[model samples]
Target chain A: MNHSVRAVDRIAPRRQGNWDWRAAGNFVAGGAGGGVLACVAALSIGLGFDPRLLLAVGLAMMGFGLTCVWFEIGRPWRAMNVFRHVGSSWMTREAYVALFAMGTGLLAIGLGTRPLVAATGLLGLLFIYAQARILAANKGIPAWRHGRCLPVVLSTGLAEGAGLVACAGAWAAWWRYPAMLLVPLCAWRVIAWRRYLAALAADGAPVGTLTAFRRINSLFVWGGNLVPVVLAGVAVLADAPILAVLAGMLTVAAGWQMKYSLVCRAAFTQGFALPKQPVRGNSRTGPGVKPGWQWNRWLTD
Target chain B: MKRYAMVIDLRRCVGCQTCTAACKSANATPTGVQWRRVLDLESGEFPDVRRSFVPVACMHCANPPCEEVCPTTATKKRADGLVTIDYDICIGCANCIMACPYDARSIIHQPQYAYGDQPIASEAARMDSQHIGVATKCTFCKDRIDLAERTGQIPGRDPEVTPACVNSCISGAMHFGDILDSDSNVSRLLAENESFRMHEELGTAPAVHYILDRR
Candidate 1:
């Protein structure tokens, strides 16, 4: 029995400072851009309008997101080194996928090739998935690493993309065609967000993160999800492209805001924890401790 | 076959912070940064309370998330299970910082001098330019271990070959050795005590083991 006396307390979840607005920008711009490209591949038939403008916009958004990442990194000159670890790194895969997506989109725009459009669109979706993987791979971050984050981020991107395209470019005549996608994708985004919130609570998160998310619940559900969806419905029913454009803008804005919250506001590091507490007595233990994370699994353990 | 590991005896550790200072002196880290840290963990109630000092650093995990997520291939795991980062190759994307569950990795954007903008002679001489703008952390005192191993001196037995933190621990609570060797100090300590690795649920297979009991 050899132990000395020492007092101890708990450590709360620490907010990560490595990634900021620049990181969120990648997810927002890249996701919306990818979504737009996917829409072009899936819903571009019989729309009586040329997609050259859409292609240019999607490529431009992707470039903007990539530049954000470029600025965020400390060693901007060595960014090309990102390609060296494609075998295990999702970021490397993202870079490669982005390059392919960019090339195919440019070629599709330049040559007006149908197969190239589909290829570029598929690559864009892959890029979004890769971005999701990048967030999920960070085990230190509880909010981003959740399994539900995949569906949430993916659905948001698709919704944002469709929303932007639905209200733009000769939309007065063909609003119904794009609205068909905008409404459904917006609804799906809502469902995904709901599941993500549910899982975060059920699966357990830092108390601060949970609070931050709860604070934005009304804004996210009403302003982002419900309101935009209702607006989209009114636009289609009333044959009003202007209302549809408003709804689309709302959908895109909401998605960006949500991503910003996830990456910056609620991105808390899984702080230190001890599974067992050692007492100042003969080789005996007390209780386990995980600061800030209070959940069934941890409490029960 | 060798796997480097550290065994920290929670019962013995008093949180003196000598190891932390020793590590800083040996590594010459910036003022705000600490590669080695001792976390003060308290649990239980007021009447029946329990507190312990947790000395933590880079675990050099068998399945290192940092190594897996490094986009530049700068982070690598040696055959002997020593996870290392190549400062020259690292682009400082901070992917490794996010991936590491232990919060062991850090990316310093600029060099900080102990005294104002002017560098004291020791600070200027000890400053590592390559470490700037890259992810850095404790390497189990890799330089000392490698140098000792190259000269055919055993790491665990030789004080010069061991980590600065382990050598500096006042309580003798920290032990470093090859866990692969059955008779090694670290393996023996683990076998004779009830030990647990931090974040074992994450499957990082962290090399740092905390002993909760004595033989």
Candidate 2:
């Protein structure tokens, strides 16, 4: 009998169907869309921008996101069942919270009441938290299950929301407030993203995942975080509202890139792990190898 | 009150894949979908290489992650400790597929004949399998087990009622019985051997056990 031993990574197979780009789209649109609405409502109560226009844009973006996910399920007709398991499932909670958010958001826009707007904004934040929890609960994917995922997803939504409001702020000449918020928020995103990557590398995540993160990292840092920070700062220095507007747009793009790389490129399933190796003849038993990660020192390091 | 379980003796298994074939025949699973499979693991350096065959299927854990993550109450754990998927209610969102760390579940997309484009009737192509887009996995031959229980016959001991893979094991490496029962074959095997479950650290508490070869 031929006893040829193949490489470990080539032998073991990875799992399938955790989530795809479509799901990522759902998170991005849902979180950022709700965030924009919430921020706009906040600005309306403070700066007196048109709540109707901001509320409309926010609702449209959120609906678009939900529709994208509606097409992704295997059984679309029974999609309402997502609300059935609220006790244990985060996805169910997200569905219920989303409904609550829309109801309050509409009331806040109609009545222009501070209490209504506060309730809407609070529920909007909860909605984003629920989205983060949905990914965190997936223990099968190492990258998604990481503790940092909660913060990363949450911050991305915040940045995206602030960015949208900043863009609108330029037109309304209220750009200073959101542009100021964008600098610190974008700075936080940059730092948090770096820490997240370091943690993944230290934990020995798959080389493919790390590489994807590195590729997407540059875009988010330079364009999403750093560029926006620069633009917002320049706007403050030069007293130019256009620079602040550009910063907001860049922040939104960065948030999109973050979710895309996470859900599509870096999202690998946690495959099989065998505790003990099988014995042959009188040879000593050895530990089973984990196959998904790359082992080359130079490439991994 | 009956908790069914399985034990595999690695020493007697020769990787013949008779059990794999038996399962496919009994269940009529669609193309590319395997309810039972034998994974061939080869390790060690040259001239002193080692080859081992591990038969892997659904663990049917005591605390099943699939049931916890399912948005619909489709994936359910029965009183007898068997995990079953209810197809009619399943939205096929693939949530349970991701939650199962064992990679035991498969989302069946389109029905295909064993023979390419033959338009033949595959018996496994009906019921849960018939649904074009739904999650499918091993049921531990629930129909046979149900029949045996109703007739007051013990499973595992009765070849006519045990899991198809366990009954087809040529080397008698596979054992199926109630681990909760003190007199059951699986309980006795567990007591007498050095055994381990796959991914035990995940706190899944799998019902399946493996006995390493005592060389």
Candidate 3:
């Protein structure tokens, strides 16, 4: 999906400088943790397996991700002000949802109640959706602003969660219950990636951003998705717990890699454009200049 | 209904970057941060090249995307059609920075001086700690405009009341006034020239418009 981009990257949109490794860590850890919580809740509600250990681990992961973002902020004490714009801001919504998710998750663990666990799972799903909206709200970035980004984030988070469910099976006796669902979730995630990339290409993204996504395309499709699905299948065929854990680990790692790429590497701003290129002497305007966006559907002629 | 706007005449601009330096001197921004900048854009092939020096700053949009994504309500628009930042409440999340399509906003994490490792005499005197860790941008010389309003003088018509960049423009390429007022400098210039706002396709409805020609 490459274009004949002869222009230098400087002529195009520059990669966003605000968010970096710390911001990427939030999506990586938070998404995986929320996914794990949802997966555990679904299984507990259906199969009646007590996933107290993994559930606690899920909460801890989310908290750790929040801590990473706290460090990224300049005024840590003023962090409470993030709730100021609940009416419009997605970050505010994410915070409110997080507070509820934590409360329900704690009550669920303390009471050992099925309904509370189900509520926590619902909150986890909301958290993932909120996080996706957080990225998509950035109209500046080409990759984040795309409508297709929602499905990619949602599917990736759930896939990672299912992977963790498979990994948790290594310690728990009733591993077969959640591990059976891992292959299907991973496949769905791959399909999501395929659709997102195709849409992004057709819409036209920053050359560097598209290139970065392309670099991960093979690793994501082959090494990440196919290998994990194959390993999970082998685990089911041979009844091997280690193989299932390996598949889960690979799936989780791949999801993290994609998120990191999306947040850090592919976060390029929609650079400056001149709609009417000025000719030297003529009073009339010439062709427009959209540097990196060769096929931008949004460009007004 | 005073919707203040800036009009840059592309035909008159010489790409001297005087406006960029004027903005920095007026605002006292730290090293490596310029609220107003000139983008050197060269498009087309070898023989048919078209180069343009586009002077850009905050659009102070009618519909600001930065204001939409600010969790703390720090990035805000005033009644005078100026976009501003409330540094006191901003937690430095940089969300507004990501949401700004014009690349106008910036957050200076640490205190940086013009000179190597130390603030110069003037830099130290004017250095603001409030902007160190929060989102900051071009305020359309809000202070000057406000002062003019208090002093009972027209903002864009008076050089003392105008934005530093517009006053400093060497070739008279820049004009600033209430765009809603038909008789105002910006409104008259826009009415007479072929004008287009940058990234108007994004639905920002940017106040800063580029005038391609002079009628």
TM-score-best of 1 and 2: 1
Interface RMSD, per-candidate values to 1 decimal: 4.7, 3.9, 3.1
List of clashing residue pairs for candidate 1: A8-B42, A9-B42
Local error of candidate 2 at residue A46 (angstroms): 4.1
Q: lDDT tens digits, residues A1-301, model 2?
A: 1223343322343524446767778888988987786677676778766677777677777777878788787788989888888888888888888888788878877886777777777777787888888878766667777788788888888889889989976867677888888888888878888777777776656656777787877778898899899999999889998999999999998898888888778877665545565554664555665555543332354
Please identify model 1 stretches exceeding 4 Å from their true place.
A1-10, A46-48, A170-172, A281-283, A296-301
- The C-alpha lDDT values of all candidates are 0.84, 0.78, 0.85
Per-residue CA lDDT of candidate 1, range A210-263, in tens?
Answer: 767777777888888788888888878897778778888888898999999998
Give the TM-score between model 3's chain B and the true chain B.
0.96
Clashing pairs in 3: none
- The estimated TM-scores of all candidates read 0.95, 0.91, 0.95
Tens digits of per-residue lDDT for model 3, B93-131:
999989989988888889987668888899889999998
fnat, candidate 3?
0.66
How does residue B148 of candidate 3 score in lDDT?
A: 84
Please give the lDDT score at residue B24 for candidate 2.
82
lDDT of 1: 0.84
**Which is the leading candidate under TM-score?**
1
Q: Which of the two, 2 or 3, has more DockQ?
A: 3
